[model samples]
Target: MQQAINKVELRNLQIEDYKELKNSMVEAYSELKEAYWQEEQIERLLEIFPEGQLVILVDGRVVGSALSLIVDNRKASATHTYEKITGNYTFSTHDPFGDVLYGIDVFIHPDYRGLRLGRRLYDARKEICEKLNLQSIIFAGRIPRYAEHAKEMTPKQYIEKVRAKEIHDPVLSFQLSNDFHVIKVMKNYLEGDVSSQEYAVLLEWNNIYYEKHQQLINTRKSVIRLGLIQWQMRPLNNLEALFEQAEFFIDAVSGYASDFAMFPELFIAPLMADYNHLSEADAIRELARYTDSIRKKFQEFAISYNINIITGSMPLLENGNLYNVGFLCKRDGTSEMYSKIHITPNEVFYWGMKGGSQIKTFDTDCGKIGIMICYDVEFPELSRLLADEGMDILFVPFLTDTQNGYTRVRNCAQARAIENECYVAIAGCVGNLPKVNNMDIQFAQAAVFTPSDFAFPTNGIKAEATPNTEMTLIVDVDVDLLKELHEHGSVRTMKDRRKDLYQIKKLKS
Candidate 1:
């Protein structure tokens, strides 16, 4: 297998490999520098990585292994935490969407030392990312001496005590050797003891510094029906076949006067439940190929239908890391793209990519709009950011199952619209998807959620498709009303703020 070189094959380790990997990790780290680490604690690490990507080498007779966990560079997400740390608020409803990566836990075997195996394993993980095409790889480093890797070290700490994790862990050294840059020092998120403080070092590897757009746009409201489609039960094994299924479903309502449409997270790829049996690296690479093909199809669909179609979440190969990104195209062939900002824990654990840069709202002939995929809308900071930046209609595209989730999200959409006084539209999938592990716990049915301003049921159900069915919701957005509401109420949330007065401090070196 190409995965194995120098008598070493980088195969994804399974539950069976957990014991060996953990032992190897403890031996290697302990030998380098003694530390107190439990077998169960290491076991939790195994659980965190589950079965994603691994490298196993056969040196002479013994087999050695290494594993990598894909963590998000979600540095500076908790503005609420900042208020507590800095003794003042950092969030003024002005800005949000943190661009940080916590690429942690790259474990290797002790017996596998010498022969530059450590660098080889690091390069291999990076190579896997390159083969698949992703955005960036961020990892967390220990503090103190690692302060060189942190956002900042407080004056008090600078004069006295040293931070432990930043100084003790070898991740900082490992990442620096790999050309990863330290972006910030995370403050007060992870909890341990007060004596040995823990601070997350945001490290990133990217050619382009992904940026956020905070500019507002002018929009008008009109009636429009939109559909969020999720065709479940498929852990998509074949890209061609999956795309065909999606094409068939969308083609059914192509000629209708629908203004827009969407799909849910992993909309174009497979959803494997069990990590132990899969190599997410390969899966992500495969999904990238599918995204390229599907995006072109989506553009063609927009041109043919003479509408603005919003393509749902797909793995976007930016550089070497695959990002959960969405695409928007108009009939004229022009396009806009939005990368997901707030990622779920599972997503970060599975893929080594960060969310988007900013809360960008695009101004189009159709309307002044913005989009937040699935979990993105769950963060209040993001909602406040969009409103602060002046967006009219926010589109939430999702793939949800379980009535509880549907209700929570559906109600949340309305709440945001009421608070922001803008328009809200959602597209969802309704079906039973086979889990990579459970194969049960199917998703809820699909529907379109609209805001209250549109007469009765203020939560407008323009034209919601039935859950567990193949369909599209079509309606016109009243961009004018959205503009009117924003001018009067929704836009007032940020009328007062003092940016320079508050110090946005992170637990520093």
Candidate 2:
């Protein structure tokens, strides 16, 4: 018997398997009053969606089968009856360009009931839904055992008991275990479902990777790769030396096909060595003079290396007032700027830096992203605002003078990732520049963080570099996982917010 079971294989339904398919369906539904599907009906299903009709065979004998069709969810209401969805078994409602996959039937022969054949067919249907980029899989699931408890409870109560594991329902329990949820309790869903007393539950399984628009060839990526440079601070003889060092790391990261490359905040502070003879405030203002030329150079590198470049944070002198700013250079030859919204006491006293008034997320080819400089990430309100704008990843380019400072930024960034249900990456400068005042020593540990859930790492850290080292941390994160967490995670922070009682509003600038 084990040897025979070893021959089990799944494939598309064929014409020659109709006889076994019909026999299996009759056997599986013997307790029900409905008749099995006819050969003509099976052929019509194949004509509509050939790949959706799946079968499992053991020792060349058909034992289980599943049938499905596509339908526009907007037209096929959740309250729709099975007959309406199937077009009275003619499948006239099947839409080739539909966003939802509708399950018609699934059955397994009694002889193969203990082999878990039905699960194989269900898994196959989910695979097809994701591959086709369907929004969800919807079906009217039967409560075959509901008649036993109909005298004492309602269908809703029965479903609740089944969900809580207090009751054992063959179909409902199995569906619940497979990550499907009841959308609604439907009545008169099937013509002769006597065991369920013509009652059924509408079930749905969402495809997390679903996108609104359909493309013959999808160019947008669901997984984005990141490269973070743990830069080392050192004196540079000229601006040309800085460009050469930047290109070396850019070329290395782009070689690995990274989508974005990030540098530490104030990474170009070494250039301040030329003006170190002046006061701290005077030298930083002089450092601001190089911002424009450096931004242009990074933009050229972004286009040449085919990677988005986050130019850390530089001194920006505007109208005689200094501001800490960062630039996002896209591979398409476009550039965007974000200013630090919060100023540290040290920055204010030494450089007389003023805070920027705006905070927003940036649109990138990979996805929506947010940038927060060293001190900006320490404040949760700024990140929460970006989260409202649908930020997928938060990049923190920091320059910490001590391990305590780095710890503050690290812990806060991790909290932002969990609270916002997004990814957070931190890159910072290490080593030292003794000649440059206020930049003498640095501490850093670059890391990528994810939401704490089953789909992510147990500790929530995707990858982290060695402490105070000059190296790159490369990691890939799936944006689809964020979609799942927003809707179905064990702890759904975004969905469970008490907006009725309190809300976070973005005030006008």
Candidate 3:
């Protein structure tokens, strides 16, 4: 039988708490008869990394404890025995520069079992992970009931059953519910462990919000180069001419060694040269017809130049309706698309396009990013939502016919960067589309924006091109700097946000 805690106190481990912690450890492991760390070894762990050690108390008496140590991931990722990893229970493997927080041990006093004290201790560990910006919490979990099924199943098969929910093991089941995923099974991980039969399951809980790795976090600052194109509008005499013009810009941008190249909204307008005589509505419908070919070409160019490309946006007809879509083609021949979420008045009334409902954040080789087209960037909620999902950069492809229209996008984009503490890049069409009605009058500029903080440019503008010009602006953006701004900026906007007063509600789909 277990008793509930009437009062509990949680804090860092002190030399005075060691005696009580050892007593609780002995009582908790009495049934399993596992080896326990001696008083001197436990004290050594506290000396090396006290921030990683915690103890829980009820009414001035220790009832539970959680021990952890930071270790260089390179060495931890290699195969090793328990003694070698833990430094004979002294946690000598501690590394200050490490990104991973390795769990040393966790146990609840027998009398406190089933009162959820263990859960509270685990939550404390997660808080530590966030505070220190650790990549993950890795530990080997014991399959406590393995000996019961050992005669009928191999250790692997036993784990498979546990994962399938066909059989429940005390340790692994509790770990899985706490967001830990199984990595692999280790053989001879522990000695004199009859309960687990000398086998352990490797588990990890990845910190999705962890600041990027050391190389990206260092002072040198790694940069992701961007090439923004302000495509010139000209009638395409033939399909071959369109491909040739597209290849020309691709070659030009590739020559600059850019990691990513982005085109302006409706960059495909010239491809509609043959159907210029059609009505505004009919011309957009005709433009939608090239969606397939344009997607294929976007992928082809992205692969050929070994660069990621955001192919502005094009009108597409889907299920008897129309949508404005942007395709992101990766250098690896893979691609993803995001539909315009907030349609402009001209888009709804003249172009006859519908706004998309869903929002998406993409995971790229460089970092996590998002795509918002034109009017979509004007809404603060959309960008905030993506920011909450770990988006570091936002790409906006826009088109505006007047100075006021361009200003609206430019201003709102800058606001989004400041509010969300993220980087925003805006590329817009800047020339005449004389043949296309509704889209003919173009006024725009291409600019890359950063958060308004000391770590970024004083003006928050990374790069900008002249308005109403046909040009491409290539700039190098340091993504790691975004991490610094989030944590140590003069004004920590993300951390200082008042969440208790109000929150943006996301409706159920």
Candidate 4:
């Protein structure tokens, strides 16, 4: 009466293991008439992608197996039937350079079902997916229990019930618990899947680390560090004083290895102290004179400090009309300007500011980004347009006179992050400039926001500066999480848009 030796191992499937693998597959799917893979089919899978074919052994016996193949999703779409995906068991749809790893089969022997061997096989596939840098792991999961409820409800209804835990579907429940989300309910997916009534679900598990191009896999950054300046507004004696203060924050943020440093909108308004005697309109016009010098000095700081700088909003006097403009000074010596698209009534009355018509996202070493001034971020359409351009981050530089104004900017910015599925970093000026008429009595709380999901903070606020305080808030955010949310989040706002009913279009004016 000696106890049986217990041992477990997981590895790539060898050709000699085919017999045991087929036996395990048959025993696991005993309800199906044709449940085992042919010897030649297993050989072909090994020939095409040996690394993708995995098997788990318990005490020198094949107890579980998982089969997968790389596929060009464009050609073998998730909606394609099992026969088409597998080329009628010939596995001709397999493409070594494809972006998705398609799971064709996974089973654990009925004897080993309670041991969580199926989970091990699924986990192993995910590890292989990440190692190969595939965009995601996709599979047509069978809803075997659907047949029981098919007479009473549709496949979709059945799926919803299973998702809500109102129904217990062995396979679907297992997949849902493992972080695999059902993209859609696929019909007639497999011919002999009688228990599933020829129905299946297109399930996907996105690999957050996936890079579209293999060459840039190591070069592209996942985590981007942001440095936001809760700038204190005070009277400045001269242009040198403003530049010195700007350089001080830049030097400090760069020292902390921040990728981008953002200053609050109209941070240079304090320099208008010398023009306090002039009217509000005339004084801001005079402040616009330093736009060129500030641009040059910030660009210099960008290159010297090796950190990208967002110059906030400065008055630009162009063609006798004033506009609030900002500069994106890349550390590589390249610079781009974005003008405020939405002008506040106060800006029009006091400064006679005219809104700019153009809006676009800028490309930076860290990622593609869009800049919006105080009033601009409050408009949902503008940020949505930027998000359409694949913008990873939306930087909003604001100057608010009171808590009510800051609340508008803060709430809208947070909404943009959640709806657009992107990061929003907002910095604003605090303190007061009593000498400058329109710039007096500022209130702000600089903060960074992220898409609301399990991957991000519960409240969606990454970091925030103390209210109406002069401080720098530094936070690190992963751009990869946004990609995952776009494809496989709890609620995919981008993908679930009802485009047929209505659409958001940029009109050519």
Clashes of each: 61, 0, 0, 0
The C-alpha TM-scores of every prediction are 0.48, 0.85, 0.61, 0.80
lDDT-based ranking: 2, 4, 3, 1
Candidate number of the best TM-score = 2
- Residues 419-490 of candidate 4 have per-residue lDDT tens digits of 999999999998878888878899999999999999999999999989988999999999988887886699
> Positional deviation of 316 in candidate 2, in angstroms?
2.7
| Model 3 lDDT tens row, 392-478 | 889898888899999999999999888888888898876777776776778889899999877788999998998788888888888
CA shift of 505, model 4, Å: 2.2
> Per-residue lDDT tens digits of candidate 1, residues 44-143?
5456544434546564322444444443334323322322321232212211122332233455555555556567666666654443333455544444
What digit string (tens of lDDT, one per residue) describes model 2 on residues 1-509? 24355588999999789999988888889986556889999899888899999999998989889999999997555587888889988999999999999888888888888788888999899999999989999888999989999999999999999999999989999998877888889999888888998899888898878888866673678899999999999889988999999999999999999999999999999999999999999999999989999999999999999999999999999998899999999999999999999999999988899999888899999989999998999898899889989999999999999999999999999999999999999999999899998889999999999999999999999999999989999999999889878877999998788989988877855
- Stretches > 4 Å off in candidate 1: 1-221, 230-237, 271-277, 435-441, 448-463, 487-509
Question: Which candidate gets the maximum lDDT versus the true structure?
Answer: 2
Every candidate's lDDT? 0.56, 0.92, 0.84, 0.91
Which candidate model has the greater lDDT, 2 or 3? Answer: 2
Worst 10 residues of 2 by lDDT: 1-10
Clashing pairs in 2: none
- Candidate 2 Cα misplacement greater than 4 A, ranges: 1-8, 57-63, 109-116, 144-169, 181-186, 214-218, 237-241, 318-321, 384-388, 415-421, 451-461, 480-509
